[model samples]
Target: MIITLPTILSIIRLFAGFLILLGFLLLARPAADILAFVVFVSAAITDFIDGYIARKFNLVSELGKILDSIADKILVIMAWIIIITYYEFNSWIILPIGLIIFRELFISGLREYLASKSLSLQVTFIAKLKTTLQMVTISLTFFSGIIVDGSGSLTTFLLQPVAGSGTTLMEMACIVLIWLSAIQTIYSGWEYFKTALGLMGTKNDG
Candidate 1:
């Protein structure tokens, strides 16, 4: 099998996911957060580039599709884990995480069932929007910590501002993004579940 550009891009995305996870472990100070931000942004870029290249070059393969989905899930899940671990544990984050994990698992099972029936489902536009929001939320939350760095403490630079510089604004912005992400997360999961059920000839139960 020839090593195509799409395959190479998919490989890059997988590596980038590993880098994001590694960044979570190594980023201790504001500077470390900066580094993590770089890694995360790079990973996000690779996600888009890989998919674009795959279609542009007509190099989409079964292996590429499987690897791409795996990479995306790993990156999103790892980023969520890192953010929740870095911040004060809140039940709010659990809702989004739970919804995300449940939706993915349910969809995967549905896909398997459909495949057994010689059926396939197409990815939807809302799914793409959900993914974009997830990426943005994760990236911003990671950077929000970097904006406020504390040594041997959970407080980030944004939380502890310099004299004459208020950190309230930054905190509010981060909170907004986090909440927006949570909403989108639930919406996306619902959309996925609805579509999956439709495929299986089932109606979505309220």
Candidate 2:
């Protein structure tokens, strides 16, 4: 495939995901948090921009589809993997993270199966909403974890509750959103599975 703007953006996102993982691992200073945040948010923005450009310019190709999906999975899945590694002992965190990963893999396999039959699974509105919610939730969680780890004034102002709860309010909010996103993930996965079944039935009929 010829190099295009959207493909270039997707490549950038793929590199951004690597940078995020490296920042989280090798960068020990508090400033590393800022680096991670910048790279991650930039990548997230490109995700939307690439899709819009591809559709608008009629540049969507088979390679674009594969690269786009790979970039997205690398970004979000790697973020979740790193997060869960730190919180492996916490069941609450692990459960939602596991669910999100499983849903992605399941849907991907379903899509591949349909593609083999010359059918395509179009993204749904709910799936887009779920992706947005997940991106926001992951971003906040990453930011808060860094701030909390650093124990800076920003954390005090944003995370600290007046009542002095054990868990910071921001942390609580992130966890809640994670769970909400996971629930939506399951729902959307179900929808995809249903579509796959429908397609399978149609294929069998003919």
Candidate 3:
């Protein structure tokens, strides 16, 4: 089996996800954090580009599909775990993470079963939208820490201590986005399960 550029890009994205996870856990130098952010963002862009190029250039392959799915799951799960670690370990993150992980496992199993039976499940537009929201929310949350570093005039203005300020407004905005993403995650998971179940039932009837 020949390795293609898309497959290689997927691997890079997976590795970058692990790097981001490590950066979150280690809390190393600020410089290292910035580097991790750069790598993660670049990998994410490649993820989009790889799929686009693969489809556009008629280069899609089984290995590319597998690697792309693996890359996406690793990046999302790692991002959720890292967010929870940084945000004081709330159960809210855990709920969405569990739903997302379980849904991925369940859907993957269903897909394999269907494939064995010579059937295919179609991806829906809502699923794509859910993914887009999740990616944006996670990326924002990942870089939200920089808002407190006093880098820009806006950051300094926003970070200014109120009479009894404990948390910055920017941090609050990140939290809101994270929660909204979680809601989308749950909705998407439910939607996926419904679609899968319907497909399975139709296959069995056929």
Candidate 4:
């Protein structure tokens, strides 16, 4: 496989996902949460950079496409795991998390089925919007945890308004957006399945 810049970036993104997971496991409370957010944000930035560079320079390749998709799934799913583990036990968070996971797995299977036929699914604009919402919600949720129970003077000073009741508001917003993103996720997944079904001749002809 060619070692293109975009491919290298996708590999880095995969590594960054592991680093973010390591940060969550090794670092202490507020610091762990903070580190995860910082690493995740950095990884998200690179995700965009790699895609743009690939499209602009025509560096897009089959390996790059597969690696990029795998990298994205790793990063976002890891973030969701962190969020589920850290957030307070509640149906609001749990339900959306479940939906998101289901969507990812189901759509992954759909994509694999298409791949077997030498076909690929086109990513919809709504799917991109869903990803942005998921990333923002995860970042905000991570930040919310850092200030949730009051991270003392330093964290408080840095977050100012993000402390006190601010954490609650952020948490609420995160939950709401998570739900919205899940809805979009299901819609996008359904679109993929519909396309796949039509292509596979599984759709009944009228």
Clashing pairs in 2: none
Query: 1-206, model 4: which lDDT tens digit per residue?
Result: 57999899899888877887898778888888888888888888888999999999999998998899899898888888778876665666778888898899888888997888777788888788888888888887787777766767754554454445544455556777788888988888788788877877742342
Question: Which candidate number has the best lDDT?
Answer: 2
Off by over 4 Å in 3: 25-29, 160-165
Best by TM-score: 2
* Rank order (by TM-score, best first): 2, 3, 4, 1
Per-model tally of clashing residue pairs = 5, 0, 0, 0
Q: Which candidate model has the greater TM-score, 2 or 4?
A: 2
Q: lDDT scores for all predictions?
A: 0.71, 0.84, 0.74, 0.81
Per-residue alpha-carbon lDDT of model 3 for 63-87, expressed as tens digits?
8998898888888777777777666
Question: What is the C-alpha lDDT profile of model 1 across 75-189, one tens digit per residue?
Answer: 7777777666654565666666666666666666777777787667788887788788878877887777665644444554346554674534555566567677667766766
Worst 10 residues of 3 by lDDT: 28-37
What TM-score against the true fold does each predicted structure earn?
A: 0.80, 0.91, 0.86, 0.86
Model 4 residue-pair collision total: 0
| Candidate number that wins on lDDT, 1 or 4 | 4
Better of 1 and 4 by TM-score: 4
> How well does candidate 4 score on lDDT at residue 138?
81
What is candidate 2's lDDT per residue for 78-168, written digit by digit as tens?
Answer: 8887767555457998999899999998888888888888988889999999899989987887787677666677667776773755666
Best-first order by lDDT: 2, 4, 3, 1
